[model samples]
Target: MRLLLKNTKLLQTKEQLQTCDVLIENNRIIAIKTDVESTTADQIIDCRGNLLVPGFIDVHVHLREPGGEHKETIETGTKAAARGGFTTICAMPNTNPVPDSIDRVENLHEKITADAKVRVLPYASITTGLQGETLSPITELAKQNVFAFTDDGVGIQTADQMLSAMRLAAKAGKAIVAHCEDNSLLHGGVVHQGLASERLNLPGISSVTEAVQIARDVLLAEAANCRYHVCHVSTKESVRVIRDAKRAGIKVTAEVTPHHLLLNEEDIKDADANFKMNPPLRSEADQEALLEGLLDGTIDMIATDHAPHATEEKALGFLKAPFGIVGLETAFPLLYTNLVKTKKVSLRQLIDWLTIKPAEAFQLPYGTMEIGKLADLTLIDLNSSEKIDKQKFYSKGKNTPFEGWKVFGIPKLTVMEGKIVYNNL
Candidate 1:
């Protein structure tokens, strides 16, 4: 099958946008030029002079399948990802049967093959059952083609256990993706230890809970010589730690969520559960640091940390509700409106954070636009504007904090492997 995308703007460099036409045959991009006339194709799309770029990739997301299907299934989660202009997403291994074994990994793969609407890369848990006491079968699971090892829902408790897991992951040639939170310092906190928590009269989660573990893990990763990736980085100290580690050549990379970059503890004026999340929204100072880190190459990419929960669960109020908010459907628009449109970050930089940066950090082969590359792309209408309505979301979870916010840069179409997965044009 041949698919043609006409009159699309392509980013030629960090500062250059070139209007061009892209032609795809089967799943590969076949041609890209200023114009292609009189070409025969099974399908043709006039992009209306919109931006056409490589599809966004999220390295951290929770598709609660195999057990928590009431929240999200592989099919629903991936459809949400497609709607968000993501062609690829990494599934966190925090499901019921936890993908800690090769058998579990294979089982999850079967579900993904049967139901996924877009590319889904599954992660293997670093600790068996995510208990953080015994290590998972890293060497065996690595051979099963899992993307990486991470006990994402919880932090590895002990330095010895983390070091051991890092050693095995290094030998197995897989990255150790960490959720850095020291439980001892948690103090049963729900929101960040700041003005919001104090005013709301709630227990507070300190930034040290995240930074201290990061400080320890970077040393362990250096000793094990393993590729280390920090997930949903939300603190200024965490950014400082990751920045210093990269400068010291510790083989470390980190990702910030759109919420972390856009919202902060100050935004949580009430007891709204939608604002609740692991490593909860931090202070504005931390938010500024995260953006600085991204600009300076300290933060490698932007991921959604797209955790979903049932509507009732999120409605339980902040203290009783679970720690998560759905993100897969609103990520691009939120970032584009708040960061790009406001000139805090350029459009090209935002695209790189969503597309090439995550791919490069994970060593994946799906984040470039060129002849012969896979035709996984997104066409975005930068001039379009609308309010984010949760009722129209494809995701099962409607827990986004950006609900009803006006935003631009809506995705018009998403093509994955030469097939149109989403179209709003």
Candidate 2:
């Protein structure tokens, strides 16, 4: 099959918005030029001057397959990812019957190959069952197609265990994605330790819990020569720690969620569970620090941490609800509307953060639009505006705090491997 996409703007290049055409055949981009007539291709799409960028990649996402399918399955999750303009997403290991062994990861890989609408990379757990006790079969599972090793829901408590895992992961040539948190410091905290926590009378989760753990892991990663990545960073101190680690030549990378960047504790006006997440919304100062980090390259990329839970589970109010909200379908629009449109960052930089930066960090091959590369791309209408509606979401979980927010940069079409997987145009 052949597809020709015409009349679109390129995001990475400095070229002006023109009537460019991208030709694809046999799942690869064959040519990119201007004034290519539509009669030469099997199919042609008039992009209507939309921005044609490389398909987005999310390094942190929870597919909830193999056990928690009621919340999200591989098919539904990947479909949602495609709709959000993502061609590749790395699945976390915190599922029922955790992906801690070679057999488990193998099974998950088979499921992905059979059902995923886009590329689905799976992670193996650092600790068996995510219990933070004995180590899992990291060496064996890393030999498979696993993207990395992580215990995303729970942090590895013991330094020795984390160090050993880092050594093994380094030897296997795999990255160690960490969820930085100290359980002892949590103190049954449910929200960020700030003014909103005080106003809501909710237990507060201090920044020290996340910052201290990141500091420890950076030292261990440097000693072991491991590629370390911090997940869902939310605090000012954590950003400072990551920045210093990068300055000292430590191989550490960090990701921030859209919610953490756009919303703060001051935005939380109710006890709704949609506003809750593991690394809860922080103070205005923390939000400012995070934006600074993004502007200065202290934060590496933007990820959704696209966790989903059932309606009944999320309806349990803020204090007792689960620590997650659906993000895959909302990440790009929210970031583009709040960050790029507000002049805090440029459109090119935002595109790189979602595409090239993540691909560089994880060593993936699907973030560019060069010829001979996989034909994965997203066509976005940057001028149009839409009010977010949760009922129109493709994923099973519709828990989002930005439901009524007006946003720009809607994804009109998504192409994976030269095939049209989703078309909202």
Candidate 3:
């Protein structure tokens, strides 16, 4: 298949946004120029001077297949991702069989291959079944096609266990994407330990719970010399820890979710489960720190942590409901609307965070629009505005906190591997 994109504003660099035409042949970009004739390809798309950027890449997402299809599947989740302009996503290994063994990993790969509309890279658990007691076959699993190792949703509690896992991952040359949390500091908490939890009379999760574990992991990572990534960074103190580690030349990278970057604890208007998430919404001070972290390069990328759940599960209320909200369908719009449109960050910087930054962090090759690269790209309608309606979401999970929020930067078209997968123009 050959496709031509014309009259598009190509996002080339932080300061060089220029109009160009792109030609894709089969699965790679063949040419990029200021103008190309319409008869050069089988299909020609007039971008109408809209933004043409690399397809968004998410390093953290939860496609609840194998065990929890009630929430989401590879097919449904990737479809949602395509609508959000993402071409590649990484799946967490917290499924039915947990993907701790080679057979389980192979089984999950089969499902992804048969059902996924976009690229889905799966992670293997750092510990056996994410139990935190025994280490999974890290050396063996690293030989497989998994992107990295993580025990998301639950942090490895013991220092010795985590240290052993980090050493193994370092030896195998795979990243240890950690869900940093000190369970000992969590006293049956559900939300951030602040005014919101106090007013709602709910148990609160302290910032120390996340920061302490991150501090410990950074020290361990420096010693192990491993590629370490922090997931859903939420606290000011955690950001400080990561910033210091990077200055000290540690191989550390971190991601901040859109909700964490845009909403704070004060933004939680009521005791609703939609506003609840792990490393819960923090204070205004913490939100400011997150923004600074993102702008100054302490944070490496933006990940959706795209956890989804059934509506009834989330209807259980703030204290009793699970800790997550669907994000894959809303991340780009929210960031572009709040950050880029408001001038908090440049449009090129935002694109790098969603695309090249993640690709560089994970060592993946899908976030570039260069010639000879994979043709994964998206077109954006930056001038349009739309309210976020959950019913319009492609994923089965409609539990989002951003319902009814007006946002710009809507995705108009999505192409993966030189094939048009979605078109909203």
Candidate 4:
């Protein structure tokens, strides 16, 4: 099938914009120009005053398949991703049986191929069983096309173990995605260590809880000379550590979540479990610092860290509730409504953070809309106004803190590989 996307403004990079027409033939873009006479094509879409940008890519997502299907599945997750303007999403491997073996990786790929409306890339576990005792079949997993190695639910906990994993990952030519949390320092904490936690009288986790691990892991990556990507960076100190490390010429990369960028601990005063997430929201100062980091290029990408869970699971009290809120469905509008529309960031910068930056970090090639590239594109109606409604979500998980919030700039249509996957009036 051929498709013509007529005159539209596009986010070409972090700060570039252009008005052009894009022609997509089958699964790749065939032509891109400022003007093209109406040629014979199967379909033509007029994107008036809308944005035609490369589809967004979420690097860290928890598709709770192979174990917690009640919370989410590849089909549901990817569908939600497509509606949110994502063409590709990399899954984290802290699942039920953990994706550590060749068979497991292949099984996930096959499942995704069968049902996913968008591209699904899986990251294999760093350790054999994510147990941190022995290494995973890194070389074998790499041969199977695993994009990265990570045990995202927790850190390696030991420097030697991390160093070994980094060395093997570097040799295998794969990126190592890390979840920076010090289990030794983490006690039975349920919320951020701040005035809100004190008022709520819940156990608190300090900012140092994340920053300390960031420092340790940066050193480990430098020593092993490996390409490392930090997952869900949440604190001011952690941002400083990442910034300084990058200045010192370390090959380290990091991402921030939409929640961390827009919300803080004060939001937890209502005892809303959806507001609760691991590396729990910090202070207002931390939020400001995170935004600063993203603006200054200290943070390389913006990921939802879209962790989903059942409403019943989250309905429990704050202390007993699991940490996380579903994000895939709301990431685009939330960011656009808060960051871009509010002028905290430019639309081009936000688009680049979600697209090319993520593709570059994963060493993939699906982030651009140039001719001959995969026809993975997202069409968004930036003027479409909407309010946050959790009941309308496609994912099995209903856990979210943004319920009832007023939002605008929603995605009206999403296309993957020249096929329309999702659309709404």
Tens digit of lDDT per residue, candidate 3, span 54-125? 999999999989889999989999999999999999999988889999999998889999999899999999
Cα error of candidate 2 at position 188, Å: 0.6
Candidate 2, residues 392-424: lDDT per residue as tens digits? 999999999999999999999999998899998
Candidate 1 lDDT tens digits, 1-425: 89999999987765677999899999999999899773667788999999998999999999999899999999999999999999999999999999988789999999999999999999999888898888988989999989999999799999999999999999988999999999999999999998999999999999999999999999999999999999999999999999999999999999999999999999997999999999899999999999999999999999999988899999999899999988888899899999987899998899999989988888899999889999999999888799999999888898989889999989989999999999989
lDDT of each: 0.93, 0.92, 0.92, 0.87
Off by over 4 Å in 4: 11-19, 34-39
After superposing candidate 2 on the true structure, give the runs of residues whose Cα lies further than 4 Å from its correct spot: 12-15
Candidate 2's TM-score:
0.98
| Clashes (candidate 1) | 0
lDDT of 4 by residue, 1-425 (tens): 78887877776645565888888888888888898666757888887757788888999999998799989999999989988888899998978788899999999889888988898889999997788888898878989988799998788888888889889898988888988888877788889998888998888888998899889988888998999899999999999999999998989999999999989988776788888898799999999999999989889999998999988889997889888888999998899999998999988788889999988877788888887888887877787687888899988878888988888778877778888788762
Against the correct fold, how does model 3 do in TM-score?
0.98
Worst 10 residues of 2 by lDDT: 10-19
Quick one: ranking by lDDT, best first? 1, 3, 2, 4
